[model samples]
Every structure is written in C-alpha cells, then in structure tokens.
Target: MFLDRVADNFLTQLVSEPTREGAPLDLLFTNREGLVSHVMVGGCLGKSDHEMIEFLIRGEVRRGVSRTATLDFQRADFGLFRSLVDRVPWEAVLKGKGVQESWTFFKKEILKAQEQAVPMCRKTSRKGRRLTWLNREIWLELRKKKRVYDLWKKGQATQEDYKDVMSNKRRAKGNLHPLLDVGGNIVTKDEEKAEVLNAFFASVFNSKTSCSQDTQPPELKDRDREQNEAPIMQGEMVTDLLHHLDTHESMGPDGIHSRVLRDLVEVLTKPLSIIYYRIIES
Candidate 1:
C-alpha cells in the first residue's frame, strides 16, 4: 500500500540487499535516479549483525581550480592592525635611518600586522556555476518530467503527469527592480541602460588636475645633491596625494585600494614618500 501511494517519480529505493536474514532493514532512498550506484554488500564486522553497504555517489560536481588570493575587507580587524602599528616606537626605530631604511622598517611592521588583521582568501572560480535560485529539488523535478515524457512516447503509460518543475519568483522580483538612471528613473530600453553604463565608465574625478600658485607644494629642498640633480621627495607631497585619492575608485595591481590608503594616511605617508623618492631617482 505504501509503494502504491508513492509515484514512480517520487521515492527511489537505492539499497536492494537484505541486511538481516532476508529482511531488507538497512535502507537508502533518493528521489533523483543515478545519484547512488553500485549497491554492494560485504560480511559483517565483529559483534555487528548489519553488513557493510558500499555505494558510489555520482553527480555534477564542480571542482574549481585556478584560485586567486584576494583580501576579504569585510572580515578585516583594522583595530588590531592599528594597535600593532602603535605599539612600536617609531621615533626610536627611525632615529638614525635614511629614507629607504625608515621606509623598509615601517613596511615590514605594517605588513606583519596586516597579515593577521586582513588574512587572504582564495577566490572561487565561477566558470561553470548554476544560478542562485536553481536548486536540487527543482533539478530532480525536471528530470522526472523528462522521464515521464519518454515513457509516454514509448506507449508505456496511459496518463503521465508532473508539476512544480520550474520556478520564476526570483526572476520576477529581479524584473520588478530594473536599472535606474541618474535622476532615479527606471530604464527599460536597452539603449538607455547602455547610456547609463557609458556615462559611469566615462566619468572622471571633479578635482583639480593641476596645481595653481596657492596650491603648489613648496619646492623640494635637498642639499646633498650634484649640480642640476632633482631634489629628494618631501613628505608633504606624499601626504597630499594620499589625501586626494578617490575612495570610490577600486584598487590597482598592488592590492592596496584607495580607501585603505586614505584610512591609513598617518602611518603610510612617510613610507609612501620612499616609494616616490625611488620614482624620482629612477
């Protein structure tokens, strides 16, 4: 009677072997076919009446490779990083050091702190992935429907039926919220959406591109130099540049984003000067 109630689409009894004296007690069930295969039985272990059951699980498993290391900023503990940097006596550390030496010391310490505060995570590849809304039960229903159709084609059934095989709720919600324009109007046309993206990509910072008389940094002053040799980098310029960095912009190849640089301006200014110093020297 229980087997009569269950449709051919629903429960699939995977384990066919009888565990104790011709009574099939040990069981395994899966709604989707071909998931569990090669049902095997072995002799029972010491003091155990139930025999060992072995089966291979087969399915669409995506073993992603080519992972990339990236900073997970959400989990970063900036307070820990700041405390680590503050515990050091910078004045003593950079007492008699040159620009390069001082920068090196700061870089070492900051990197050490950053390692613990912002640990790296391996980014998973999305080459071949399913949509967020598509789940396992939906997939099983699709397969069941397909099997019912095949059975009907072969004249094996009088009436074939399956329902609830697809879902569009998420897609309906997605369509409800379309792309908006600058003035907060929903854009429906493809051309309008394209225009919005083009406008965003073409936009640049509104800040001044050049320095006028009032804003020009004081000329670099380095006494230890050959004739006509460029002056050494000043801390003021480095600080100014860090301050002007647009937080909205994403990070470059160095993995250091504008927001992080601006946030750590005080600690990074001197070390950043060394970076510019080498550039000018080169």
Candidate 2:
C-alpha cells in the first residue's frame, strides 16, 4: 500500500531527455515545497556522455552573526582598582549581616570595583576559526597557492605550475589536522570528535565523586568532610589563593579580572574571609 502511494506521488518525470545517448534518467526530484526552483542540463566535461545537471534552490539562507562582550585588559588600570577597593567601607557595610546578606553586599562591592577598573567592549565572534597554529605565514602561503591555482584554471599557467601550487596547498592543510584523543586516535567525524573531547573534559572537571572515592576511606569520611566544611576561611589562605591567580586569564561576565583581585588581595582578604564565613554559616 505504501509503495503504491509513493509511486503515485513521486513517479512523475521531471527530466525530459536521456542524460546519455540512451536510457532516460530522472536524477532530480522535487516535492510540493518547490525547494528546487529550476534545473539546467548542459554538455558533460571531457569525453563523458552524461549531461551535467544544475539545481537552483529558492531563497537565501544566511548564518547568524554572533557578538560577545570582552574585557579590554589592555586599557585596564590596576592602581585605580586598588583605590576603588580601598574606598569601600567593607567593615561597616557587611557588618551585622546574615550569610546571604553579606554575600550580596560583597558581590555589589566587587561589581562596583569592576565598573571603575575594567572597561568592556563588544566585537563579532570569530566563529571559533582562530586556531593557534593558523598563523599569518600559513594564511599568506594558502592565498598564494589559491591565486596560482586560479591562474592555472584560467589557462594562464602550465600543468607543472598548478601541480606545484596544489602540492604546497595540501601540505598547508596537513598541518591543520583534527585534534587527537587521549587514546592517541585521530577523531574524524565532527560530532564524534566533539563528543570525545567533551566527555574527556567532563571527567576531568567533575571531581566530586572521584575525589571522595580516592581521598577518603569510608570510616573517616564523615569526620574529614566536617573538617573540610569549616565555616571560617583564613585571611592568609585567601591572600595566598589570590596571589596564585593567573593575571592573564580572561575576565568573567562580571568584568572582574584576576589581575584586579591579585592587586587588591592584601586589602580584600580580611573582608572576603568575613563574607566567606557568613556564607558558610548561612
């Protein structure tokens, strides 16, 4: 029954002539949507007898342009940031507050500090094509090769010249192969490659289960957990953590860079520790 319906709907012929000398072939098909507006049949290339078919798809489809907010680290002023933090009356503002209140107040102060210190700029996203290995030299070589190939195609260059340029182009492409997995296998398909990469990273970043299993025995786990969950974060510990922060790391959505925190660590450690204790208690 399904075969009869399909035959009734799709058996209608679109092409009028045989692609070759004999045996008429209907290579193109279109439904009621009219996705393919028109078709062109032309002579085959070289010594081939089959006709070349060109389908014209209706309407235009374009990719969406993406933009991202990025911090202007080059124009940042760390000295001004220190002054901004110093101006804040953290003791008076955050005193006599519950954990949530203290956290909210601390966040507000940090935001204020960020506004004064960091500037943000919006730019079109690069579509993730800015690979570390795709440098200017390689791009220039690729452009040169493309120009030579185009010239050869237009009959301005000889076969030898075209082959040489193509060889160089292939070598440039070989340098930009897909990323290898931890098992040293080259992932080819885009979806499979992305899944492999995401799975590997997920295992690395998800440390809760792994840490509990490896670091704590069943008998002492509860006691160790209690100790680990102690409310008070020492000022020295906060300062040490701040000092270890990478200054070159990118800023978060709040526009606060590690450089800002690192610079004002001495002034912020005590107040931050108080807030941390409040949050823990809450």
TM-score of each: 0.36, 0.41
Clashing pairs in 1: none
Top candidate, metric lDDT: 2
Worst 10 residues of 2 by lDDT: 222-231
Q: After superposition, which runs of candidate 1 have C-alpha atoms over 4 Å from their true positions?
A: 1-59, 127-236, 246-259, 270-282
Model 2 lDDT tens row, 138-196: 77877988888788899999989988777765774322225567785655567877888
Using TM-score as the measure, the top candidate is 2
lDDT of 2: 0.70
In model 2, state the lDDT of residue 230.
Answer: 44
